[model samples]
Target: MKKRICVLAMLSLCWGVTDATAAGPDLDGYVEFGGRLFDVDGDEAKFNEYRDIDNGVYGNVDILSYWEGGYYIDFLAENIAYDDQAYWLNGGRFGSLKYLLYYDEIIHNITEDALTPYDGIGSDTLVGTGETEPALWNSFDYKKEREKYGGDVEYAFENGYFVQFGASNMESSGVMPYGGTSSAEFPAPIDWEENQFNITGGYRAKKLTASLTGQFINFDNEDDSLTRDDTIGSLPPDNDVAKVLGKMVWRPEYYGSVVALNAGYSKTESDEQLGIVVPGETRNFDGEITKWHVNGSWKFEPIEDLDLKLLARYDDRDNDSTVLTTLDGNENENYSSEIFKTGIEADYKLSRNNRIDGGYHYLNKDYEGRSDSDGADDNLFFIQARNYSLEDVELRAKYSFLTRSGDYTVEPGETDEGYRSYDVADQDRNQVELEGGYYGVEDLGLDLEFTWFNADYDDTEVGLVELDHYDLYFSGTWAIQSNVNTGFYVGFERDYSEDLGDAAETTYYTYAAGLNIEAYFMAEKLRLYAGWDWAESDGKSEFDSADIIDTDEVEDFTQHILSLKGTYFIDEAWSVTLGYVYEEWDYSDDQWNNYVIVVPGSRGDTFLSGAYDDQDYEGHTGYLSVKYKF
Candidate 1:
């Protein structure tokens, strides 16, 4: 509330300044006033999941003013009285100096119907109740709020040099569900903030350009631990990062050649206090990680209708965390990784409307102090063809193949038995894609796309075995006249994966489809618009083993959205608009539908019904607004 008040006061002051100093033909902008009403049938949280779209009054203001010396100011404020509000202000001269200020707020609504059996919720400490009755529990909502404010400035010199600086701070606070020591769940408090700063300088010339940047970031958490039912758990710790980056691009005066280079280095560190300490161990832990990368590319045209490019990169990460020798009698693993990659590509024009492209790439990764395999290497090859020889028609097709090999030998005492990590497993992947577009019909346009992908991990005995994906999409648009148009799009997708385990061999599948249609009509005095969209998805998991049984559908969902609006121009300087929106959602999950709130015994598991329940809703909204331009 204090933030909102400050924003209002600032806006008022700006208006006062404008009224006092503005002369004729020096000011121009628009202001809009509006109000919205909502009618909902189900949970409100589902309707306003990541935004604040409730019944309220809203206003928007935009102003632009300039002086005779190439100086100007631009300001905009939106959703003035709502939770999802934003404000921006910027001023500068033409190609000389510029500054900016901005602020925004967002609300994340998790759930509005949740029940708990603990006292002192949303605090550091919580008390337990022996009773396991569901009717006697307390009800509360789970949500969070995030706010950010920032500003930046830039200055340019006449000698092809420029500098920019920026800073921002963000804070988040709320309560969310977390699992406790036992089978019970609790709502935990959250309070954290992050601050970031960066500065950059660059030089621009006709043949060469270069830039360098330095950045620093810090993060803090107010509550480091929580106590529930005689058990204490540690939360997120304080951390910070500092980094520097540089980039350069140079162009030679021969054969349209170019060269580019980039490099960066960063380090992150964290400190935390231990909740439970041994007799001979320290009370705190300090951890650090460092990373660096360098990459470069060169492109040149060797002859007529031929172009070639080469690129390469190297990356490294080092982890140096505190060892727990005094407490556990074992040293911590470094868990570091390094990567090197190189690639070459070529493009040739068969004719004025025909072209072909091909590329080959190789990558290798190495790991230290890992229980899994040591590392993996990959090789990829691809080719593409495009043609625009037919009048008003275009076509494109591409194919790619890749292979991966890893060292799967396990160490005797350090590795898990009969386990293979997928990240370093032996695999083969293939993909194919095709796209086409036609504009031969007068005032009509059409496009179509299709894709297929497959991955086989045949060498592994107890991990992912196979994966497949497919997609198809189509869209079309028709322009009946200069001021009238309509368009529609549709898409279909499917994904499948198969895995092997000790007890059962499981396969998971998902399928989805979506459609959208839109129309616009412009008249002499009134304009009209309409849009509609619908989507549906379904998922299933099956187990094929001697001792396990398959199950029914795991999840299903559907959504629909419709909107209509019209604007009536009373005159050149004033207009009014009326709009309506409708949204419907239907969702279901098999696990949540059969879950029990509390078990009967003292040693049984307990749960809060509100934390993971399904949401189904239908909502309607209407708004009216008037705008004036000067």
Candidate 2:
């Protein structure tokens, strides 16, 4: 009640001011109040039971009242005096009818997990004595705050000529530690902050338009957290980067309608640090990297029913590093790369309801590792067709081919400097797909799709490789009534790979099916849904050992979700809503286990197989919200 009174008082104050001046500016805004709760359960033993509680009262208020004779002001505040995890303020103005200004500030809190790679130390190596290592895991949480302010002013004439200029600055701060440790173990957490500023100006005419924009970013480390001997040292500070872009458009009624041209330039620079452990001693290395890119594109309609586009881009990167060792050793290494890409595309309408499109792209990259340089090139071409009939049926088909060649470099031995390199050539791939959908039935639909892919790789250092894959899928949905519906889908995929020599090739296959049912009631405000999913994948791969490995897995999962929500109209300017949701994820079989090990590993390889071990996950979220609009 107190909060409501405060809001009403503020609204009344603004209204009083507006009423006094017949020519005053208009005022408008809305306020929202709500809260949320969540819970999670999984089969992996590591995540058998997890709970997160997030509940808060939030709202926003904005006042845009102007004085007589062309003077205006606007103010906005949100999450006002609340314990919730979000807050912000924004306000701006446009003088009379020509100038503009604005500013905003926001803060947020997020909870997540952290996992760091094991630098081949201890029992975490993939080869040698300590092979098949486990990843280190820890729970993480952090808070972030961001602030920005900028605005643009423009003068418009009855003519097509209009000019505008604007500039903005943004800043953010968060916690970043050197070593991938949980927040609980940090003696002193490093404060990380970054700032960016940009300025843009443009002009527009009847047949031509152009704009130029430039931006810069700087990152700094405010506190040092990691010690020299702790495997992770203090992070670098004060990294500066900049980018500039220019765009132009031209449209002449003569050559088949609209035509536009665009061009841009970007550059980045950063100083990076790397830590290595030699025997029992630790060493730190410093490196400087610079990268630049130039790109351009052209678009136009060459015919009455055809559209064409052409694009090209070039990028160059250089790295210079100072290597340091525990034995007071120092050396310098340089790496450079140049990459180029170009592509052309065309789309043509065969009829009023049918269309066809095709594109071709080429990429070339030359990389210099130390004193040696290697190059790789790739070419790709694809074409697709789509047709739509009056009966509510749609069909699509596409085919693509890609060929690539390249050489890669790596470190060979244990050294603070460069050591290993590999050369690769003749890598090619081809793919074909077809899809169709039917929606002629009232509140019912069906979809089907199939894809086939093949790839071949021939390398002198890594041996020859060949791969093939096929995929098929089907889905359909039916609306039992205006408030109820049901749907189901099934898919199958297979992959086969072969290598040279007596090394046995590997094959993998996956099959999945799912069904969903949903019903809505209470004037479409309340909804309930239930679903079941089953999937299985089997494959074999060659481990570090000479022997061939085999893998077989299957998983069945089900989820039940229920939600109830309704809105109550208290008055013309006020309303309230109550809502709740309950969901669960149940898993059965080894398929879930494989997914936990592989998918999570890619995110810093922090796979906690134990996290989802023997149990399923259940979550419940509920919220109540009230909104007032004027």
lDDT of 2 at 604: 59
Give candidate 2 regions above 4 Å deviation: 1-30, 35-53, 56-190, 228-237, 257-260, 271-289, 300-306, 320-333, 370-373, 407-425, 445-454, 460-575, 584-617
Query: In model 1, which residue pairs have backbone atoms overlapping below 3 Å?
Result: none
lDDT of each: 0.80, 0.59
TM-score versus the correct structure, for each prediction: 0.92, 0.66
Query: Candidate 2: deviation at residue 315, Å?
Result: 2.7
Rate residue 62 of model 2 by lDDT. 60
Model 1: residues with Cα > 4 Å off, grouped in runs = 1-21, 24-29, 67-69, 180-183, 274-283, 324-332, 409-419, 501-522, 546-549, 599-606
lDDT (10s digit) by residue, model 1, range 1-630: 647655765587457547745473277789899989999898788889888887778889888877788887777888886778888888789888998877788889888868777777778787777557868877778888888878899998899899999998888888888764455677888788989999999998889999999999999988776776556666788899999999999999898999999999999999976554222232577879999999999999999999999999999999887755544567657789999999999999999999999999999999886767788999999999999999999999999999998875663233362466787888899999999999999989999999999988756667677788888888888887767777888888887777764333333343333333334434457888788887777766677675655545556678888888888888888999999999999877676665556632544655554675667899999999999986
Residue 178 Cα positional deviation in candidate 1, in Å, after optimal superposition: 1.6
RMSD of each: 3.1, 8.8
Per-model tally of clashing residue pairs = 0, 20
